[model samples]
Structure formats: structure tokens, C-alpha cells
Target: MNRRHFLQLLATLGVAGCWGSYKAYATTSSAKARVLIIGGGAAGLSMAARLNSVLETPDITLIDPSNEQFYQPGFTMIAGGIYSPDEVKKPQSACIPSGVKWVKEKVVSIDPVTSKVKASDGNTYVYDFLVLTPGLQMNFDQVEGISRSTLGVGNAHCMYDYQGAQNTWKALQEFSQKGGAGVFTNTFTKLKCGGAPKKITMLTDDYCRRNKTRDKISVTYYNASKDLFDTPYYAGRLEEIFKERDLNICPQHRLTGVDTASKKV
Candidate 1:
């Protein structure tokens, strides 16, 4: 059965109780197992699903802060105006298997030796096995002259967040309307979903073309790396696209600061 139908049947029969008993037996037997998974993102959820499908019954607890789960790959499409935010977002409850315990809270600290984790809500979770899939945190504040609060507000926009993706769409639309040179920069640091920056840039270019502002607006992409993409094959293709569109690509150029008032980078 599909996931939705399985969830409906589980809910109708209150199968969560049966799973609780299974969890107890697994934890108590000589072969008992208790798995605690952290982050509940792509990796964590996929692991849980695989384990659940193989085992007759599984003891799994997944910890995540947000009830809303996002397909991060879709963020690139969202920035490109190819998909809506809602299309990329799914309720965490839907992805979580019924048999697994889902904790909605942030992990504050981890005691690896004891195999215990402490959450922001003061709950202590212990397990026989621990799987950590917490993703890297972005430090936008590290960008000089850019404050954490200024993101998605003023001349700054990043697709790291859903709102940030919408902000980028808005910024591109406004720039198209005003008609000016727009500089899009990606830092030297390894960013999640590396194609995201160029995706936005291309989308902006497409928008300008559609609005008949292509000549008035100049698009430049600056990156510390020498290539458009990490992979040679993809970089070659991207270079061709950039050349065809007359989009300027500046390699080995890193963004130091943004002068929002002067509208220069």
C-alpha cells in the first residue's frame, strides 16, 4: 500500500500502541535494540524507512525541530520559479513511520559515551544505537556588512531558507522592473546544493528576457572557484550556456562585502 493509505490504516487501528509493545520487547530481549536517530532529514528518514522495511518490527526514535519537512532539492526549483513553496514542503508527520516515535524538538547536547541525548525541552533520550544526521548550519552572519536579520529584508537574499527563496524571486522581479546590473555571488565555502546560486542567476536572466529588459540588465556571477561547476562535464555545459546567454562569469573572485546603498558588490 501507499504511504498515505498505510498511515490511514495505522491511525484507524491505533497501531502505535502495538508498536510501543514491540519497542518494549525489542529493548528487553537479549537481541533487543533501541535506535535513536537525530535530525530527521533526508538521510535520517531514509535510513529509518529502510530499517523498518527489513526488520519484522523496529525500535526507532527520530528527533527533529520542525514539524514541516522540506525537500531541499526543490528549493533550487523554487528559486527558479519552477515550483511553489508548498509543493516542496510536506508535513513531517507524513514522512515519519507510524511505528517510530517522533520527537519534535531540537537536540541541545549529546552524550555519546552514554548514548544519551538532551533536547532543548529538557527531555533525556537514551538508546542502544545512535545515528546522527544533523545537517550543517549556515553562517550568513560571517558575510561582512551583512547581519542575520537583514536577510530577505533589504538588498540581501539567499535561498538557504524557504522565505529566502521567495525573497530571491521577489528581488529578481524587482530588479527586472527597475532595470539595472545585478551581481550574484557565491562564497568560497562549500554550500549545500552547489547549483542553487546559478539556478537563481539563470532564472533571473530568463525573467529579464521575458520582460524585454535583457539589454538593460547585466548579469554577473562571481565565485572563488575557477570552474562554473565542480564536475568537469557539467562545468563545460554551464560555460556553453553562459557564453550563449552573454552572462559574465568571474572566476577566483570572492565577495567581501556588499554596499547596499551604492547597489554594488
Candidate 2:
């Protein structure tokens, strides 16, 4: 639906508290509305909390299958050995607002026409207003010879997943000790954090440098875009730093597949 139409619908349902203006209003009354949130990630939980606080009697139902809410930004830190996996995880039940209802089920399909959603448990949910905060999903299978189950195999690791971040840490440690060509690349499709590929790349570089193995390793970063970064303010300086460090950067190179057995991408 269009933004205007959606806003009008929310007003019709008595949920006029927009996120932008929610902070300005005090909760002296309750809103008679049913808000159905379809995710339990940061966005979903945060929205649920805001609604619960602004509305005294918030009939909010959040549908998600995950048992834990993860601090996804910390995943990169975990890969760099700066944070542990447990540090970035919290129970989903604890994160949800006290009054909000939590439905621990994945959404199978959503029928906007009927204002109903079908869950994996074979139940349909009717809602007055819907908030979709479903987070990104990684498609490792799109890359040949590399699936979610085979992460860390042949030193192929991605920091996006919890276990994958830990595995990347392990691989980084091994790489630091036995220096070799370390390749880091960005995916062709949109990703959660654009700077993550650069973060892990530079982290690995610095890791080897601190370990006194900098000379033994050759690091190369492959960028799907022609520019290393899009921000004009920092791109020039970042390029200079990469050049100073003798880091090989190949632009417009999108990773299509990988050969885990041969450690090739």
C-alpha cells in the first residue's frame, strides 16, 4: 500500500501515534488498536517497546520464530575477536515488551487484501494495523559450493551468522599464524552492513600486523562496485590508507561462486 493510504488506515484504526511523533506525546490514555508486528529483530522489538510505552493498553502481537534477539552490529566485532557470541545474544522473550504478545512462529504467507497473515503453525492472524520488520536473510546457496552448513570450510567464513562469526575468528587466528593470501569480497546483492567487508579485511590485516606476520600475508579486497565506498567525505581518505598499506583492491568484481576444497573464490 502507498504511504498515504497506510497512514490513513492507521488513523482509521485509532493508532495515530506515528513513530516520529510518539516521543512528544505522554501516555495518559490507551489506544484501542491491534498492532501486529511480524519480526523480533531490533526494529521489531524497538517498535513494540515504543508502542507499549505510548499506549497504556497496547494490544500488540509480534510474530517471529527466533528464540533470541541478536545485536547484529556486534557480529563484526565477534569475527574480529573483539566480542564473544554470547555478548551479542539475548532471549527474545526478555526483549519483548511486558504487555505485548509474542507469537513464536515464522510467517508462511501474508494476505494484505484480507488483512490476515498465515503462520507456519497453520494459524491465520487478523490485524487492524501491520508492522513488518522482518530482517534480512542470507542466501549462501546462491554461491556455488558454499551453503550455510558449510561455513568455515576451506577457511570460507562470513561474519553475518553467529557461528560463522566465531568460525571466522578461528580462521583469522590460523591465518595470522600461517600467513597466506587472504581474500575478502562484497556480495553482488544488498547486504546488512556495507562496511563489514572492509572491517573484516582491515581487521585481518591489522591482526597479522600485530602478530608480526604482516609481511607473510597478502590481502586483497574485491568490491562489487567501482568505488571502494560511496561516501564522498571518507572515500578519498580510505583509498589513501589502502594504498599506504599496499592492500590490493579490485573494483567491479562480484563474487559468483567459490571452490571450498581448493580455497578459491
Candidate 3:
């Protein structure tokens, strides 16, 4: 849905991100309304907490199946061995806000027309209002010849998931020891973090340099976009740095396939 429609829907229930305004009005205006939130990630919890804090008596229920909450941005750091995997993990229970009903379940499908949500438990929940923040999914299968099973094999590696990042670390250590060409590529899609590809590339480059394998290791960056960064100033500086470091950058080229058998992309 568009931003205007999304805002109008929430505004119908007098829901606003601002705690002070919501507290001043929503409690008196919409306290009795039943609110069900899908997903227990940062956005979902923050929304639930704000509602719980502001409502005189919140009727809020949050549904999420995850046993643990992850600090996703730290995946790159984990891949580089800069931070341990445990540092990014926390029990989902600990992060959930107080005064809210928590249901450890996944949503099978949502029937917006019927104001119903069907979950993994085979139950339908009806709500006066609903919020969804389940987060993003990576579609590795969309790339020709690439599958989830292909990761951490040969030169194939990614740092998007916790296990994938840890595995990438292992592959990186071995690759660095016997220096060769390493390819770092970005997909042409709305990825979780825009800076993630660049971070992974630079981190790998740093590791090679520190290990005195810079001359032996050739790092090539394949950027789907023409510019390194969307912002002009930063993009200019990044380009300069890449040139100084003698890094090869192939812009406007997206990775469409993975040839795992031949170890090519």
C-alpha cells in the first residue's frame, strides 16, 4: 500500500508514532479497540511498547515465531570475525515489552478483506486494528543456479544471515590464506541495508591487506548501481578510496546467476 493509504488506515484508529500525542488522545478515543500485531522484530516491539505505554488499558497481542531476536546489522562484523555471533543474539522473550500478550506463532496468511489473520496454529484472529513488521526475506533461489544450499561452498559466501555470516568467516580465513580473486557483488533490489555490500567488500579487503596478501588477493566489486553510494559526496570519496586501493569496480552490473559447479558467478 502507498504511504498515504497506510497513514489513513492507522489514523482511522488514531494511531501515531508520537507517544505524547497518542497518549493524550488514543487512550480516551481508542482504548477499547483490540490491536493485533504480526512480527516481533524491532519495529513490531517498538509499536507494541508505545501502544502499551500510552493506552490506559491496552488490548494488544503480538504474534511472532522467532525464539531469538537478532541484531542483523552485526552480521557483517560477525563475518569479519570482528564480533562473535553470540553478541548479536538475544532471547526473543527478553526483548518483548511488558503488558502485551505475546503469541509465539507465525502468520500463515492475512485476509485483509475479512479483517482476519490465519496463523500457523490454524486459528483465525480478528482485530479492530493490525500492524505487521515481520521484516524482510532473502530470495537466494531467484538467482539462476543459486540456492540456499550453495552458500559457503567454494567461492560462494554471503553475510546476510547469522549462520551464513559465521560460515562466510570460515571461508574467508581459508581464502585469505591462499590468496586469489574474490568477488563481492550487490543485488539490484531493496535489500535490508544499502551499505552491507560495500562493508563486506571493504572488510574482506582489509583482512587481506592486514595478512600481507593484498598483492596476492584480487578483490573485485560488482555494484548493481552506477554509483557506490546514493549520496554524491560520499560516492565521490568512496570512488577515490577504491582507486587508491586499486580495487576493481564494475558498476551497473548485477549478478544474475551462480555457477557453483564451475565455481563462477
lDDT by residue (1-265, candidate 1, tens digit) is 3445434333333332344333332321112367788989897887677556534557889999888889988886787778898999999999997788899999999998887999999999998767788987888878776765687544778887788887777777788889887788887887787888888889889978988988888988997799989999999999999889989999999888776666566
TM-score of each: 0.84, 0.89, 0.88
lDDT tens string, model 2, 1-265?
A: 3556546534533455544443453533344677899998988887777667766567889999999888988989999999988999999888988989999999999999998999999999998779999988899999898999988888888999888899999999998888899999988797999988888988888888888999989999999998888897777788888888888999999888899999899
Q: How high is the CA lDDT of each candidate model? A: 0.78, 0.84, 0.83
Candidate 3 residues 1-265, lDDT tens each? 3446435434543554433443443433234667899999888987787667655667889999999999989999999879999999999999888889888989999998888999899988898778888888899889888777777666688889889999988888888898888888888998988888888888888888899888888889999999998899899999888888878999999999888778888
Best by TM-score: 2
Clashes of 3: 0
In order of lDDT, best first, we have: 2, 3, 1
- Candidate that scores best on lDDT: 2
